[model samples]
Target: MATCCFLSSSILRHPSHTTPLQGRLQTRRNFSFFKITAIFWGPKKTTTPTTRSMMDVSLGTFTLIGSPEQKPPVEPKELQQVSISVVSSISNVSSIDWDACAVDANGQGIFNPFLSHAFLSCLEESGCAVQETGWLPQHIIAQDENKNTIGVVPLYLKSHSYGEYVFDHSWADAYYRFGYQYYPKLQSCVPFTPVTGQRILVRDAWYKDQVIDMLISALKDLALKLQVSSLHVTFPTETECQRMKKDGFLQRTGMQYHWKNRNYKNFDDFLMDIKQSKRKNIRQERKKISAQNLTMKRLRGYEIKDKHWDSFYRFYRNTTDSKWGQRYLTRDFFHNMGSKMGDNVLLIVAEEDDKLIAGALNLIGGDTLFGRLWGCLPQAYYPSLHFEACYYQAIEAAIELNLSKVEAGAQGEHKVQRGYMPVATYSCHYIVDEQFRNIISDFLVHETKQMEVVMKMMQDSGPFKDGLE
Candidate 1:
């Protein structure tokens, strides 16, 4: 997520928001027992400290609120009756049912690792994104009269807007200026993740549309019920963004650079498609690794050992601590998530003289390689090391996996020159006060226009010979 980068507007940076995010979506799988049993990974469970990460996403229970049977804003007669409920943790819902909605939401087969039950639970259980950290889970769910879970929204009762890439501290401050309390606004996202996907996840069913609309209504209803200032859905799909905007959410846009795969056989094949100058620059940049006497390695799944996680933590802190910011993730998060996610985790490290100097972490999606976190040994600056580790290596891995794209997190004009072109990321905000909503809506209209111009300009100047396809 380029966790240290100051994304969005002034609200994006000030008030200590100057960081990236954790994509906040959720899913689950079947399990043999209840109470979050320790589910070991790999052929054998290596000895490690007992942590929440070992608790597998299998079967689970949920707390449901009593909502009288009602027809939804969108009428699908097939759905007899449905109710929406809120829970404090993803653990309350079965991973299989939660993940079902997460998967079917896209209507495409692409799997978002950040949206998975395994990923979201790691953030919560690791204590990285919790009430103490200002991210309290108030996840919304939809179910039919028969108690079948059909939809889910990963949400947080936010005390501040730090983890969400769609910064709104200015909005918060405006509320303060008006003597309003905005500290407890609602956030719908994967805590600390900025990657784009669905936020209102509804399972593929005859009643899908009704479930989606009802889920949204539930989100707003809960916000109003709690008297929160607003509700925000960050990094949602364009379709979801538009739907929410039409339903009165203020649409906001931001830019991110992503690299696409054209079925390239290899990295060189990918380079050949870009402008010659860009291609030459990339080749030269990649060459710097050998010149620096550094060893580059991309370890996946079981290949990543405890020592690698240990080094990556130091590297991550080296970046986070630079902003005088407290770290969002604990060291235990890496081990717990790594052990659970396995091959889905890609740890790219740079070693010099047998010492780990730097590392970049990526999560494998169905078709996209997510460039998540990257950092190096404090005070160790190697030429082009950041690009090689975070961008080029990500592109290479994407190509190798036959993936469609490489999302290089947030904020870097340099990424454009290296063939990562800008794309619009969408978010929508629902302000409760009509007056404030009108004001922010006007602002969003202008910001969206400006964002379009920036995106068009970036597209025109892309490193690709034919521009973005």
Candidate 2:
């Protein structure tokens, strides 16, 4: 016979309306029938063991509590049983299983290459995201009774928030002011990536909802056990944001520039949609490349070579060093990504006199082209080269591949004048301390409204001809 279990009962309140931590005690109940088993880390586990009694509610979530001597918790009939474990690396799980959870999470064939096992593993294998760099992998995996992978969450115990595009330095500063350490907080995101997608990877099983709920519960429990300052899930889908909000996470909104393709036949058709000035400006920029005697090539799969990776890495280092930005990605990362995900990798290179001078890196998605990194050789300034390599070329590639849009990376208002319009990106935060949670919640409320206004303003000012808005 199958086992039934009661997950946990805790008050689920909207973050904004909740009372101060000292004043309220409320409980909300959800039912599951899966046997929930949790594995503890360290010599002596700090997390509370499973038990039958109602767990204490800590800031609107269940805080685990029990001694080994306590009787095993009763399995509530209505609850679905799940087993969750933490792996120090993504390599611990098979790629097929991990990819299954990632791509089939929503029952739709939603594919995000960034979240794929191959891409994430490359980050680890290349040493770009590792304990040494402060992105220690502490991924959460959920499984059903049959031992099938039901869900996974790409999580990390971050020592600092550098690569995550969602800015939280203010929160860190606030923590320091209060004499609290914030470096080792838990984060769920594609390191250095800001594109929105599902962070909680759950398969389209009958128990997907339960697994998601369980994963969130387990995340909170682990945070308490590890005693981290908070848990942040960045760049999750809008639907995921709403679900997380219901579970007490503070919702945040930000913007990115994206160029949407409206079934254009070619680059010329795309240009026609924009205003005459913008179209002429783009044509003029394209002319600069030809005037400089530069040749542009879009290399994919085996067409990209080791020499190209080396050149791109140099360009990347130069770009980052000039800006005083940390070189978070190592040389090996580029080679590894090319080897593992070559088909999905697109490298746009500008060649002059048979020598590569600059390059832009992008990863092809199911229907979107993600523009990630771009760099040029030192003192090799060609007129409008940056615009050509990064923006126009990407748009042309998208048109040729018939992809949906080009999600140029974060925070560039200039993209608006080039037909890329502002779109909202989301993140959700869970603050362990109640006071801080309320403070952040209030700030997000204001920030969200401001973001909405900015998005509308950007759309109005977009390069597209008037009726397009």
Quote model 2's TM-score. Answer: 0.83
Poorest 10 consecutive residues by lDDT, candidate 1:
25-34
Error of 2 at 16 (Å): 34
TM-score of 1: 0.83
lDDT of 1: 0.77
List, residue by residue over 1-469, the lDDT tens digit for candidate 1.
1111111221111122223222211111111111111111122111221111112122123232222343343344442666677777899888899889899999995789999889999998999888889888878777777888888999888778887777676566556545557767788998888899999988887667767777777777766667778889999999999998778888888878888888899999888888898899899999999999999999999999999999999999999999638688999899999998999999999999999999999999998999999999989889999999999889888988989999997777788888787888999899987766766776565556656655676678778877446
lDDT of 2 by residue, 1-469 (tens): 2221111112332333433221111111221121112111222112222212112212222212222333553345423446787888899889999999999875687678999999999999999998889888888888755667778899888888899877777676656555557668899999988888899999876556766888888888877777787999999999999999998899988788899999988999999999999889989989999999999999999999999999999999999999847898989999999999978999999999999999999999999999999999987789999999999999999999999999997766778888888888899999987766766676565556546655776687778887895
